[model samples]
Target: MTTPTHAHGHGHSHGHGIAPVSGRSLVTRLRSLMPLLGEHRRLIVVAYLAGVLHQLLLLTSSGIGAYVVARAAGGASLDQLTGWLIALGCLIVPLVVMSVADSTSAHVAAFRALADTRAKVFAAFERLSPGYMLERRSGDLGSAAVSDVEQIELFFAHTLSPLAVASTVPVATTVALCWFDWRLACVLVPVLLLLASVPAWLRRQAELHGHELRDSLGRMSADSTDTFQGLRELVNFGAHAQRLGLLRGQGARLAKAKSGHGRRGGIEYVATDTIALLGILAVLVLGARLVIAGDLDRSLFPVAVVLAAMAMLPVLKVTEVARELSMVASSADRITTLLDTPAPVSDLVSRAPAGPVVPHVRFDDVTFSYRGDQRPAVREVGFEIRPGETVALVGRSGAGKSTCANLLLRFWDVTAGSVSVGGHDVRDFPQEDLRRLMTLVPQDTFLFNTSLRDNIRLGRADASDDEVEAAARAAQAHEFIAALPEGYDTVAGELGALMSGGQRQRIAIARALLKDAPILVMDEAVSNLDAASEQAVGQAMEEARHGRTTLVIAHRLSTIRTADRIVVIVDGHVAETGTHEELLAAGGAYVELLASQLEGFVERAS
Candidate 1:
């Protein structure tokens, strides 16, 4: 439940969840993950210690059993036999308990670290370019956040401690075996080495299949989400079968990936097991020869055989989990790639602008292009909205009308020039401060699944019920809200699905009005409303714009007529700037657009 602190550090500590280092290789990916464990790193260390203790107790039990086997038929006494039996019984309880404790602690630590990492990923999302989200599917990102992070648990909980025990116990047992008899130890060493190398031999195949499986899982998540959301539309349009067929194709691909991954896992397990069994067989054969030649004591030969199995056991432990090691590696790669994506905007940690700032917005010779674009989306676009002035931006589709609004908001920095607000560069203001001064009411404003009252209250959480109603009245949302079964208490449903497009737009307008920021940017807020609804929303829009610096990107000719000045954009530049009538009289780009709409030459609204 701990929150990661958003501070640059004097070396990393518990509060910082993101690692400073990054690399694409599996080993470096793993190294990067270590820094993110934060406070839970101590728990992983404890788990490793417990795993070692558990293996040591198991080895002790194995050695004692060999003593009874080698001596019972050699005329050993009943008392000698009973003492070994009691010692074997004494070892079992702690061994089982320590084994469970080791696994349980590792799992707890891993899951907590995963939680911390997930939280950090979400925090990173807030600072990443808002444009990045527009280019990716929500479900694909969700799979990374939820499923990918969850898969990494195998690395921390199962593989890491076992790998540690595999490294420690084999060397420790080899030393113990040498003390018993050096030749016997030498006989088992080569076979144990082969057993440990099985995973490495298949690492490439494992990585390939692992990546394919992860890709299929991500695609499945995204397609399934799309199928669900569009089910109603698909059914209505008689396209449901086509969507279902697409899903079936995806399912087949996912199944094939899982099958390939599983087949490789089986191969790894068999190879590891075969090598371990061979090591024990070699020990028995060599030990029998030594015993027959009188070069080794008969009693010590069984102990040597037991020690050989002991050496193989640790390696077997590591190779067994190696089956899932690819999954851990693949998941780690995805998580690191996302966490390492460069933040599009830097906060610079500058202080908020001083004094009573005006809400006027100015885009001065701004030029901006989206990431990976050859041509600029907005080129040399310049305009200004003085305090309390309402400016309308009109353009044909893809003429970069919305780009001007986005530039003023600083969602993406202008590539070649400055965007200023209140006579100061927008880049100098922290994003938090800029957001506080401006509110955007896009055509599709997201409404959470909550009571209507609460949804509007999101604009200003401390606003009173009376204040909420007053804002709704200003946006003409009050009448419709009152007619609902529960008035303001009615649930909005997911994305406001229960409401019509016009009603939703009005709700958004009300929310913005409630925020009462000095600057308002409405990007085609009423573009989707019908004739009747448009009139109501237009009046609401006028009410909301009073005394506020407003920027409007409108599609309807009627709405544009009310703006104090009109700026016509075409091909990413200003085509004309004047009042609606003045532009019509000038016979410039605005006149052509107006004539096109009225003469049926243009098929769509601006």
Candidate 2:
């Protein structure tokens, strides 16, 4: 049961700061997108073939114009010109048809690849430890899931086709020009390079700006979530104005960053325009010179210049799209890191075979600590709970009571020692099977924004409606639920905001009863209830504990007075273990805790 620690990648620091996700070089970023295409190999083949054919049709269109001008320059007949026009129509129609079909195929293949990649990303995270997941931000993780995978779509839909087309178009265009005259092809090559370089510079600036933008957006989302969750606190303290000012400041920073990138992007567009115009001018002047010198046919020169000029479309388009795609690739890297996160310890042990039910649990010399802390939360702690016994763990706030609850549930493994249930090491039990044997009513009860019946049914998804009501009755929640506007159908509204604390606690207890696990852990379930409600819930808890190995964590002395045994914990170790009267008579940690609560109880009663 030793909880393992993983060494993060070399650049990862142990400090309490968020580090940028690492391990993606330019090559890996490109490779990650390649797998998506490989996954749909057949579709990719068909799509690329369509793209190449589409480019060829375009090449043919340009060739038709070249033939028309060359024929006219040689003083050919009007009848021949009319025949050339008809051939031009044939080339133009296929050019349009194949281009449309190519786009359609790319889109279909891109979406299917995206779907497969998304499923794998989510599945990988699902296999990681819950403890590791809780440490990350919900908003940041949300951005990774929705926004990150979307970026890869550009790789399939646009990047792939443009790459294939750019490669073929320039090569084919260059060869045709070379056949006419090498000087024209030579002049055009440099122009394409200059135009492509402009966007590369723009993309470098964009990558830096994009990183800042993503960070600001993540902070904005985190702050927004915090504000909504703490609305009551903010209103009560009149802190809304200050929080709003902070949000506005972050928004302004993001806008400034975006506008700066936009300005640089405009400069890039102007650069591309200059390059294109220069290439056209060079081709025109050279073609005219060749015609006057009688080194080229007058009609062929115009047609050659036009064909060379059109070839810039795919090259220039690829450069521009590649720049925008770097931002998309940023999202891809973040998502890939999350999906690639390795589990700290591999679950290699096969599940113990299920046989006789053993309700007993034993912790032998257990030790545990949180991820970064130097001090252990629970150290050298050992105990045993026999079948059908009710044991209460009583402690001050940081005495590791909840840590013990987490240990029993196997939310994390111990740093050292063994924890076993029913004579099987907890680690040897399948996670799902181990969970099936235990149920918990946490200190802070959470009910989904759903009906009372549906909320209770979460304990056992397959439980019948009648079985649900029976469990509710046992938890003393049936009467109040029946009196509600819609009875069991009443909406709980975000974490049971529609119900009182006592009502939520009852619902949680009902869930535990419905689960009907042999081992139950109730952590301060009645702590927030008023005296009358506490009395009601405590009675329900007592009923629920019958014939089960129950472990209750309580702050209130009265709640554990009837517990078969009470263990007092102090500074991660059990200081005393005995009946309530025995511990009180012993006059140690229990005596001090009881005295503090007695004063509060007297004040409330008065």
Candidate 3:
């Protein structure tokens, strides 16, 4: 069975643009979060309604106070005053209740939305290509995932419900004031509109500075993380002071950026407050004149003044959250960018292929390039491995050996041609199914910060303790593991820092052994091992290779001598292919590589 040529183009479109995400308008970017808001619509609606009720209670209290003052001055009965006081006292309990309910509901909804957003972001990270992730700084990505996502909570909790109250409360208060005197309502409406426009006028400046602040903070985070991860290297090279200086420089820039944005926000706050105060003052002066000229009733003058103050509260609320909205807009933009990015490899085929697992692999006229590279990393590369054969790929660094392995794993699709397994295009199988058929032991084994037993069990999650121990014995790791204080229960620490390089490599081999996939790819599997450990690992590989396909990527000649065939890769092309001795006898690239290694060894010895 052979895959048809058209299978290569089944779900991929070469004509689609593969550019980085572009910046969008603030409104458009923030609107992307509506789906998250819609998820908890009931909580949002309850919070908004509570906010409205809370504002209305305040307005009613103000109106009742105005009536009591007017009636007392006009010599009303003590009975009327007592009745008014009772009504005012009665509003307090529900007022406090509504206010608390509003705050609690909004905050709960915000946190829930945040949780969903982070989950989706994590899922997006999982779907994106490893190559794409490698191009970015891990710390910067962390900032987007953790810090940027946190910033959005302010918008959800404070801005969303308050925006609803701001829209409705002012109009309701204005209508109530009109029932007292149309003249006072006329004076306050235009002033309220001016207060609301203050934030809009400052929006562009806020957006510009907010974006700058977020970017500077992200850069600072990346720099700090990189410095810490490489602290050991810096100290060994006596470059700690220089690296510290660079870190301080990042900190200084971050401080400067934050200060600039803070200064502008402070100024906007002051301006909005001044406008709100002046609006209240205008209502007072205008209402007093109307009362004296006999155009307004004296008793209702205080009512108009108090209502005007109540009306401006919503506008003030809007202004208070306007700065936060600007800041959240920047955060929302970053998250949108991450979510919008296209996955480098699409898993279009969902079903597992129906056939026996042959373990044969083939690369047909494959070409690939890194995202920003001018030249292809691997050009017109092709290879074939028969069932149960062991093939070694020998090459210098950047010779596209690892790229070939990546293509086989379908970490990336071939830029041209196809990589097929068992006569089916790798793309025809789901990514999980394709990967399940093979196992990889990378040069730098990444052990989780977990027990030694659990790290080995990662390859086969359901493997029993006995099965795990058996795999460890096959890789010659059971001895060292058993010698530890807690044996298999010992923690590996970060990246297996608690263990020696050779021990880590053996554990990785044990993991691959436990997986027991039909196709095994070992990338410099013995490069970190000492002579004794290498011998043990070599025996393990020999035992594991029986009746299975194996691909070994190595620069060490001794490691490949036992391979059935050796293919020397030069400058992304297959330069020679034959048995180990045959390649050396041919006096080609493989022999030259061997000579170079020998020359280096001799030089170091001298």
Highest lDDT: give the candidate number: 3
- Ranking of predictions according to TM-score: 3, 1, 2
Q: Model-by-model lDDT, in order?
A: 0.82, 0.78, 0.83
Answer with 2 or 3, whichever has the higher lDDT. 3
Cα lDDT tens digits, model 1, 570-591, are 9899988999889988999998
Q: Clashes in model 1: which pairs? A: none
Each prediction's RMSD to truth? 6.0, 3.6, 4.5
Counting clashing residue pairs in each candidate, in order, gives 0, 1, 0
Residue 200 miss distance in model 1 (angstroms): 1.9
How accurate locally is residue 13 in candidate 3, as Cα lDDT from 0 to 100? 27
> In model 2, where do residues sit more than 4 Å from their true spots?
1-24, 36-38, 65-78, 92-97, 202-204, 344-346, 598-606
Q: Candidate order by lDDT, highest to lowest?
A: 3, 1, 2
**Top candidate (TM-score):** 3
Model 3: how far residue 69 lies from native, Å: 4.2
Clashing pairs in 2: 69-299
Which parts of model 1 have CA positions greater than 4 angstroms off?
1-24, 73-75, 89-97, 300-302, 600-606
lDDT of 3 by residue, 81-137 (tens): 998999999999989999998999999999999999899888878877565465567
